[model samples]
Target: MPQPTPDRDDQARLFREVVLVLGGVFAVQKTDDETIRRVAAGLERVYRRARQNQRSTTSSQALAPHPAIAGLLRITEAEGDEP
Candidate 1:
């Protein structure tokens, strides 16, 4: 059986934890720009690979943003489009 989706509160908490962990990494004085760039590139690769896997295994609807995350995705996309 498929796993149940997390509730909105759990999703929000997870997002916040992700942000905090990433922020902490970047905040460290020893973290160099090159390291940050590599971290970002690795994350991009992971995201792309996961999306590809999902596409091969599930319908496009499975890739739709969970309702808890839809607004955040929209805001992030909007910010990403900004110069």
Candidate 2:
């Protein structure tokens, strides 16, 4: 049987936790906007590659990266692009 998907509330809570952790890392490391954006872009590339690998190997339902992750990457990339 397929596993049940997380509810929206659970997803939101998880997203918040992820954000908090990332924020703490940034604060602790004093990461600049450019570095953050580069990190995010690198992460996105890795995520996509992993997803492709998983899809090729698995017959089970395909998993997606969270929207919050995608959003964060997009925001960082966009911010880096700005002066």
Model 2 reaches what TM-score against the true structure? 0.38
Question: lDDT tens string, model 2, 5-83?
Answer: 5554554565567657877899899999998888677656545564344444544686676997789879979997999
Q: What is the lDDT of candidate 1?
A: 0.67
After superposing candidate 1 on the true structure, give the runs of residues whose Cα lies further than 4 Å from its correct spot: 1-20, 54-83
Candidate 2 runs further than 4 Å off: 1-6, 38-83
Compare the candidates by TM-score and give the number of the best one: 1
Candidate 2 local lDDT, residue 20: 75
Worst 10 residues of 1 by lDDT: 50-59
Against the true structure, what is each candidate's TM-score? Answer: 0.39, 0.38
